[model samples]
Target chain A: MRVGVVTFPGSLDDVDARRAVTLTGGEAVSLWHASDSLQGVDAVILPGGFSYGDYLRCGAIARFSPVMAEVIKAAHAGLPVLGICNGFQVLCEAHLLPGALIRSDRRTFYCKDQDLRVESTDTVWSNAFTPGQQINIIIKHGEGNYQADAETVKMLEDENRVVFRYINGNPNGSLHDIAGITNERGNVVGLMPHPEHNVDPVTAPTRDGIGFFESLARYLGALASRTQGGTA
Target chain B: MAKIIVDVMPKPEILDPQGKAITGSLARLGYSGLSVRQGKRFEIEVDGEITPERLEQATQAADSLLANTTIENYVVRVDQ
Candidate 1:
């Protein structure tokens, strides 16, 4: 599988995201924010960072980047896309996912090892994990609180779209303890935690994040086989 | 040139952490009975006369790019 990790200006974790992809046996393709092309990669990952300096809003300006035009289009066409941290903010700003991320309830930046419960493994990005499984991942952000209207929250719950929920304690005070979510089609996913940061055993406290990349590779391989079978 | 000013504010039902922090800070500083709701303001310059249609256009633009309607409500008015 070839995964393209986009590096917007001020992007800090694109390299780690690429390394995670490579570690999971996928080709990591470097992509730029100014380019409109996706480079024909099978999947795309928008890594964490202060894109456009997190100006105005966390992802308000970066959503208009040329690459997002293609990302949005391809995402709607059933392409698998994952947005981590600042990338998750970008996805929300782009309206690919519902709701918004406001300042953390504490109004301070938080960096710690977060415990997350896999609320749903129905999406392509989370299939490797079973529902209700607890995973430890790192989270770092000041404006990571997730919120949505009550109606939308109900809808997401009814549809089983809420992907991950914070366990033990709510770090940022996200509504319903939501840490990650997927679109209705399950092709696009966005999470506030840094899964890529946990892929390496030497640096990460646990190799728990390897599940995300492994899940993506399995999903892409299954998708490719389905396409080939359809043609055959 | 005409300027269209847009203000985007968080929905009343939504929690504004930044505003809450400010309110707390003010209370600590001996301020009382005051509340704050932080918002954003944008000034846009248009190339033509500011007509009702232009104002409406700016309003529409505000809905798409200037704000996230999911959690915010925006008001557009011509800059006097």
Candidate 2:
């Protein structure tokens, strides 16, 4: 399976994201923010970093990049997309996902190995884990606190869109302690955690982060098989 | 001409630890009478030639970039 990792200016995690994809047995393609093409990759990953120097708000300027235009369109067409940390900020800024990320409740940048519960395994990117499974991943950001209105939160919960929640503690005072979420179609997932950094056992807080990349690879492989059979 | 003010605040569901810490400090400092809530505000100016619809679009543009809808709420006003 081929996965594209987009590199926006100031993106710090693109290399890590690509490495994770390669380690998971998928081809990692480099994509530029200025391009509107997906390079025919089966899925896309928006890595983390202070895109556009977090100027005019985090992920705000990055959302208007040419690549995001294509990403938004492909995501709507059921192409799997995963946004991590600042990528999550970009997703929300682009309105591809609901809610927003603000400064942490403590008004301090947070960085640590975080425990998160797998709330939904139905998403294309989360199918490797069972629902309710707890795993550790790294989270680093100043504006990682997630918030949304009560009605919207209720709606997301009812629709099973809440994909991940903080297990040990509320790191950033996220509403409902949410750590990650999926779109209604379950193809687009966004979270303020650095799963890419945890894919390798040597570098990972634990081996838990590999599940994310492995899950996406498995899903894409299955999709390829289905397509081949249909063509035959 | 039209003017819009947007106020962004963390929703009530999420605890504002910073605010709490500030309030605690205030109490410790004997400024216990102060109540504090943390948020962001924006003042936008639009030209008179811009229609209400156009101004609303501009406001939305600024809001999506300047305000995070997940953690912040925004309100807009027009002045003639």
Candidate 3:
């Protein structure tokens, strides 16, 4: 399986995301923000970092990048895409997912190992974990608070699209303690936590974060075999 | 050239942490009975007379691209 990690100007975690993909037994491809292609990867990861110097707004400018045009099209076509932290902000700005991430209610940048609950495991990103399972991941950001209208929140709740919710306490005042969510199709997922940062046991608190990549591998492998079988 | 100014702000219902922090700081600095809401201002220069149709087009663009309608509201002004 091949996963593409996009690098926008000032992106800090594209390398880490690529490492996570490689560690999960997949080929990691580096994609550029100005490029118009995805390099034919099976999956894509929009990694974290302060893109464009966090100017104007987080992920606001990067949403207009050439690569994002392709990402938007591919994501809508049911491609597996994951956005982490700043990448999550880009996803929201791109309107790939609903809601918006505002400044943290605490009014300061926060960095900590966060506890998250797997609220929905049906998506390609969370399918490897059982629903309701708890995982520890790292979250570091100033504008990490997530907000949406009441109707949209209710719709997300009704559709079971809330993928991850903050456990123990709501760190950034995200409505409904939402840490992550998926689009209606479940192929696109975005979260404010750094799952790639937690993939290595030596550096991170746990290896629990590797499940996201593993889940994608399993999904893509099954999909590939099915396509082959259909042709055969 | 006409300049279209668009101010994008967080919806009233959403929490404005930056605004709140600034408000607190202002209070600490002896300013009272005042509230602050932080937002972004965009100045768009277009080549044409600022007609109603052009203003309307600028307004639409501001609403769709300059602002995230899900969490924000924008006010567009046409300066001739």
Candidate 1's iRMSD: 1.1
**Which candidate has the highest lDDT of all?**
1
Model 2, B1-80: lDDT tens digits are 46766566756655666677788889999997887777666676766655779667856864666666566556665544
DockQ of each: 0.76, 0.54, 0.81
What tens digits encode model 3's per-residue C-alpha lDDT throughout A26-118? 999999999999999898999999999988778999999999999999999999999999999999999999989988898778898999999
Encode model 1's per-residue lDDT on A9-107: one tens digit a residue: 999999999999988889999999999999999999999999999887889888999999999999999999999999999999999999999888888
lDDT over C-alpha atoms for residue B40 of model 1: 92
Candidate 1 chain A lowest-lDDT run of ten: A212-221
Computed on alpha carbons, the lDDT of every model, listed in order, comes to 0.93, 0.86, 0.92
Question: By descending lDDT, how would the candidates be arranged?
Answer: 1, 3, 2
What is candidate 2's lDDT per residue for A105-202, written digit by digit as tens? 77778889999999999999899999899899998988888878789889889998999999878987788999899898989999998889987878
Measured on C-alpha atoms, candidate 1 has an lDDT of 0.93
**Of the candidates numbered 2 and 3, which has the greater lDDT value?**
3
Q: Please, what is the TM-score per model? A: 0.96, 0.86, 0.96
TM-score of 1: 0.96
Residue A110, model 1: Cα distance from true site in angstroms: 0.9
Which is superior by DockQ, 1 or 3? 3
TM-score of chain A of 3: 0.99
State the number of backbone clashes in model 1.
Answer: 0
CA error at residue A214 for candidate 2, angstroms? 1.1
